[model samples]
Target: MGTTQLESVPEPKYWHLKTVLTEALDSEFSVGEILPNERDLAARFGVARATLRQALEQLELEGRLQRRRGVGTTVAPPRMGVSVGTEQHVWPGGPGDAWQSVDCTEAAPPAAVADILETGRDEPVHTVRRTRMSHGQPVAAELLYVPASSVPDLSAIDAPAGAAHARALLRELHRLELEGQDSAVELGSARADDAKELDRLPGAPVLVVTTRYVAGARTAALSVATYRADTCRLTFGDSGGVEIHHPHRHAS
Candidate 1:
C-alpha cells in the first residue's frame, strides 16, 4: 500500500474578496447602485480596510465598479473602447484624437525618453503635455517630445510659447513625411504627476502607451501616454465599436 500526499493551495484574501464581490454585483447590485461604505464592507467581510479597498480597486479597474471621493462606490457600466492600432502610421492629433494640449516647455525629458529620442542628455527638447477625456471624465495624460532639429522653422521668438508652441510643433511635424511609427502598451503604476492629471490616486494601475514617430532617417517625435486601464479598452478598428470583457479570478 502507498500513501499519497495532497498539498493545500493558498489564495490571496483580496483576490477572494474580488470574486465574492463580483458575484454579489452580478446577482444583487444594479448598475449605478451604490455599495456599502468601505468600513461597513470591510467589517462585513472580516478583512482590513486596505484589503477590502484592494478588491474594490480591482473591480473598479475591470470596469465593474466606480468609486467617487465624496460620493460612494457604485456599479459601473461597461468599459469604453478607445482606438489604438487602427491607422498605424499617422500623427495622433489628426482626427478622432481626444487629447487636448495643456502646455509646452523646452526641457530635458526623462532619461528613458531621451534614449528613445536619441538626443543628448542635456539637449532641451519641446515637451508638450496633453490630457485625454472620455465621457467627460479625464482618462489619460501624455508627453510629446520634439527635438529642435525636427522643426527648424519654429523660432526662438515664437509669438506664444506654452500651448501655442505646442500646437506649432505638432503642425510642423505634419510637414515632415511620416515614414513610420512604432508603439507599445504595457502595465504600469501611475506616477504622482500623471495621477493628478488623470484624476486617479497615486500608484494606480495604468496602461502606458509609448510611441516613436519616424521621419526619413531620424526619430521626429516620441509620445509617452498613461491611460486609465480600468476604464479604457484599447481598440483598433476602422469602424470603432464597443465590447465588454468580464475578468474572472480563478485558481491555477
Candidate 2:
C-alpha cells in the first residue's frame, strides 16, 4: 500500500477525495484490480471512511469501479461506444451493426413506451432484449418493441429463438421501406435489470437513446438503448474533424 498525505485544499473533502482517488486509479491500477479496502484507503488518505465512500460511489457511477457483494471494489474497463445516426436504416442483422438479441418475449409496453408506440395501454408487443458489445466490452443494452401487426410472419421463426430469429423478423419487416427515423438522448440511471446486464450497480449513470422508425406515414417500431456514459462521447451529424473552440478561454 502506497501512502502520500494529500494537502488540505479549500474544496469540499469529498471532491478532493474523488480527485485523489481518480489519480490513483489512473496511475496505480489496471482494469479489474481490487482496490485496497476502505479502511486502509482512508487511513492512507487521512480522511474519514464516509468521505472515501462518497468518492468511491461517484467513481462507480462513472463506470470506473465495480463493487460486488462479499468482494472488494475493482477498477472497471472502458465502456463501448455505439453510434446513433440517420444513415442507411437496415435490419438488426445487417453487416457492421453491433447489436445481438439476447431474448424475446411478448409483454405490454411500459406506459411511456406505449405512448410512443401509439398503442393501447394493454396491447401486447414483442419485446426483444439486445446487448451490444464493442471492442469486446458491453456498451449498451436495448429493449426493442415491435407491434404484431408490423411482423405478421413471425410464426416461421425457429425454436430456441434469440438473435437469429429476431434478425430474421427484422429483415422481413424492413421490406416496408423504413423512410426516416427520429431520436432523442437523455441522461438516465441504469435500472436493476439493466444494471445486471451491464455489470454495474443500479442507478448508474447512462445515456438513454430512444429512436422511432417510420414507414410511410406510420410509426413502425421503437428502440430504447441505454449506453454507459463515462466512456462514450455521443457523436452527431457528419464526422467533420473540426476543433471545438472554448469561448471562456482567450489566447495569452
Candidate 3:
C-alpha cells in the first residue's frame, strides 16, 4: 500500500489511516515483527503522529497488534476461537478439561458471590484458582467458589490443600446431580490479580465469563473466568447456550 496523503476523505483521518495500516500489516508484516517507531510510521503513512497513534491504539484493541514492555509494538497472532455455549451439564475438573487447577484456599467471598451462594456475607468458602493455556501461553484465568455445603464429603485425608484440595472439592461437587449451568459474558478491564495471571497490564481489556453451576435446587458452585480480550474471539451459541472452546487445542 502506497502512502497517500489523507486530507479530503469523508471519514475521520485516523479511521482511514487505521484501514491503511491494517492492509499494510496483512501484506507486509509477519506475526511477532516489531513495527516501525511512531515517528517513522507517521512519516510513512503521511499522517500526524497523533493520528497514527489513534490508529495504532485501535488496531491493538481489535487484536491486530500488541504493545509490550521493552518489546515495542508487534504484529499479533490469529485470535483464538472460543465458544461460550451452555449446552452441556458437567463438573469443572472433569477429564479432558483444558483449565488446570492452580490453588485452593478458604476465604470469605465477595458480597456478590455470597449473594449468589445464598451464604452469609462474611461467610468463608472454598476458593479454587485455575488457569488455561494455549500454545504454551496464558490465555485465561478463573476463580471457582465452592461453598462448604457443596462439597460436604471432601476430607483432609483424601486431599490436602492447594491443587490437591481443588481437585478433591471438584470431585465432591460431582456427587450432586448437575441441574444446569448459566453463563454471562461481558467486556471488562483486568483487575490487578487477573492481569498478573494473564500476563497483561492492569486495566487491560478482558472478556469476563461468569458461570453458575446449579445443583440440589441451589447454586452449588460459581466460576468467574477472565479471558484475554485481545486473543479470544467469543461466539455465543444459539438459544443462549454457553461453552468454552479452544480452537488451537494441542494433541496430548
Candidate 4:
C-alpha cells in the first residue's frame, strides 16, 4: 500500500474555541466541576495559553464559568428566573416563594433611597433585609425601605420590631391601594454585605433591580434587590410568551 497522509485541520483561534469549550461543558462537565488548569488545557488543545484564557474569560462573563482566587475555574449552574413587576401582589411565603426574611433595622434611609422615598436624607425609615433562596441556594439580597409617613399607625402592630415592623408597614401600604410601580434594572457588583448575604465573593457581578411603589400620589416605599448574575434571571411581565433567554450564551 502507498503511504498517504491527510492534511491537518487548523485549530480556530477565537470563536471556535468558545464553541468547543461550551460543548465540553454541556456534554462532559457537571456544575461546579473544576476545569483543567489553563496551561494544561492549552497544551491539550495545541493552542497558546493566552488564547485559552481569553475563551475562559468570555465564559466567565457569560455566567458559564466561575473563577475563584485560589480555586480554579469551574462550571456554573443555570440561573434561576425571578419575577419583577408592578402588579399588586403578596409574598406567598409558600412552597415556591423562595424568600426568607433575614434581618431588619430602623435607620435613616441613604441619600439615594431617601430620594426615592421623597423624604429627607436623614429621615428615619424601616429597613428590611431579606435573602432569596432558589432551590435551597441563596440567589439574591433585598433591602426594603419604608418611610414612616407611609405607615403612620405602626405603633399598634403586634409584631416585633424591625423585620416584623417592616412587614407590618407593608400591610399598611397595601391598604392605600397600590396605584402603580416603576422599576429600573442595571448591572452592578455586589457590595460586601450583599455579597455575604448572597454567599458570593465580593465584587461578583449582580443585576440590581430598583423599584418604587406609589400609592395615592405619594411614593410609598423603595426596594433595592441584588441578584447574582451568574445564578439568576430577572423576569418581568407575563412569562407566557416567547422565551427570551439570558443575554449571555450558556451550554445547552
Candidate 5:
C-alpha cells in the first residue's frame, strides 16, 4: 500500500490557551474574581508571556475578563443591557436614559453629521457630548448633533457653553414632539479622543451607533455613539447578548 501522509494544521498556541482559559472561567472562576498574575499563568500554560497576554486580551474582548491599568485582571460580569430601542421611541435624556451630558458648543459638525442632518456642512449645531457609564465604568461616549433651528428658543444666552448649556439643549429637544427615530450599528475602531473617554487605546474595537431623530417630518437631531465593543451589549430587541463566537474579531 502506498504511504499516506496527512498535513498537520496546528491551531495557534494562543488560540488553544484562550479556549482553555475560557473553559476555566466557565467552570472555576466567578465574576469579579481575580486571576493569577500573568507570569504564573503563562508558566502554568507552558506558553510565553506574550502568548498568554494575547489570550487574555481576547478574553477581555469577549466580556469574560476585565483588566485595569494598575489592578490585575479579573472576571467581568455580563455586559450591561443598554436599551437602544423599544416598542415606543424615546428621545435622549428621556426617563431612565443613562447618558450624562458633559458639555455643549455651537460649532460646525463633521461631514458625516452634516450629511445626515441635511444641513450645510459649515452650518453650526449644538454639539452635545455625553458619556455613558455602566456599573461605575465608562462604557460609551456619544456626540449628539442638534440643529440650532430645532431649538430656536435655545439662545447664546442659555447658560455658557458648558455642562449647563448641554443640558439645556437636550431639554429644548424634549419639548418638541418626537415623531420617530431610526438607528444603525456597525463595528468600528475608536478614535483617539473617544478611546481616551472609553479608557482604551486608540484603534480599540468599538460599536458605532448612529441615530436620527425626526420631528414634524424634519430631521431634528442626530447622534453618533461609540460603545466599548468589549464591554457593551446594545439591546435593540431580541438581539441583545454577549458576542461569544466572534469574541476574537477586531476592528480593522
Candidate 6:
C-alpha cells in the first residue's frame, strides 16, 4: 500500500491508522519481525507520531505486537491454543503434561484454597510450583496444592522440599484415581513473583485457571495456573486444535 493520505472520517485517526497498520502487518510483516521505527511509520501513514503510537499501543493490547526488553516492537505469532477442558482431565504432572516441576513446599494455602480442599485454615499442605513453556518461552505458572489427607501414605523420609519433593508428591498423587476435575478461568493481573517468572511487567494481563481435582468423592487437590493473556487462547473440548478467523486477523 502506498502512502495514501487518510481522508476525514467519523472514526478517530488512530483507529483508522490501526486498521491500515493491520493491513500492512498482514501483507508485509512476518512473525517476530521488527516493525519500522515510529518516525518512519508515521511519515508513511501520513499521521502524527502521537497517532501512530496510540495505534501501536492498541495493537499491542490486542496481541498483534510485542515490545521485548532489548528488541523493538515485533509482530507476534497467532496465540497458542491451550486445552483446558475436561476431555484432557488428568493429574497436573501426569504423562504428556507440558508443565515442568520447579519446587515444592509445605505451607498453609490461601483461604480460598483451604476452603475448597476442606482443610483447616491453618493446615499446611504440599504446594508444588511448576511452569509451562511454549515455543521456548514461559507461558504459564501453576501451583498445585495437595492436602495430607490426599496423600496419607507419602512418607516424610522420602519426600522433603524443593523440586525432588515436588516430584515425589506428584508420584504419590498419581496413585489415587482421579474421579473428576472442574475448572474456572478469569482475567487477572500478574503478581510480583509471577511477573518475574513470566518475564512480564507487574500488573500485566493474565488468564488464571483454577481447577479442583476430585477423588473418592472429595476434593483431593487444587491447582491454580496463570497464563499470559496475550500469548494464549484457551480451547475447550477434545478437538485438539482450533481455528478462529477475524476480519482483521486469524487467531489459532
List RMSD in Å for every model shown. Answer: 5.3, 9.0, 7.4, 8.6, 5.9, 6.9
Per residue, candidate 5 scores C-alpha lDDT tens digits across 96-201 of 7879999998889998889888889999888999999877789999999999889999885448778888888888899899999888889999999999999999
Q: Higher-TM-score candidate among 1 and 4?
A: 1
Per-candidate TM-score against the hidden true structure: 0.78, 0.76, 0.82, 0.74, 0.86, 0.87
- Cα-based lDDT at residue 159, candidate 1: 52
Candidate 1 lDDT over 83-170, as tens digits, reads 6666667885777677898888998988888888899888999888998886667888999999988888888546587777778778
| Pick by lDDT: 5 or 6, better one | 6
Provide the global lDDT of candidate 4 against the true structure. Answer: 0.75
Q: Is candidate 1 or candidate 2 better by lDDT?
A: 1
Q: Which model scores highest in TM-score?
A: 6
- Index of the highest-lDDT prediction: 6
Q: After best superposition, candidate 3 residue 57: deviation in angstroms?
A: 1.0
Q: Which scores greater on lDDT, model 1 or model 5?
A: 5
Please give the lDDT score at residue 235 for candidate 4.
Answer: 70
Model 3: per-residue Cα lDDT over 58-143, one tens digit each: 99988888887899998877776665764777789988689999899999999999999999988999999999986556889999
Runs of candidate 4 with Cα error greater than 4 angstroms are 1-15, 32-40, 48-51, 67-73, 85-97, 161-169, 244-252
lDDT of each: 0.82, 0.77, 0.85, 0.75, 0.85, 0.87
lDDT tens per residue, model 6, 66-159: 8888889988777877787746569888888888999988889999999999999999998999999876678899999999998887766476
Q: Candidate 2 on 1-252: residue-level lDDT in tens?
A: 999998876888888889888778777777777889989999999999999899998887676777766777977665544456747566554677678878778879999988887888899998878987754557789888888878877876664677666766777677677778878899999999888887667987889999888876777889998887764556665462233321221123
Alpha-carbon deviation at 191 in model 6, angstroms: 2.2
> Alpha carbon lDDT of residue 201, candidate 5?
91
lDDT of 6 at 197: 88
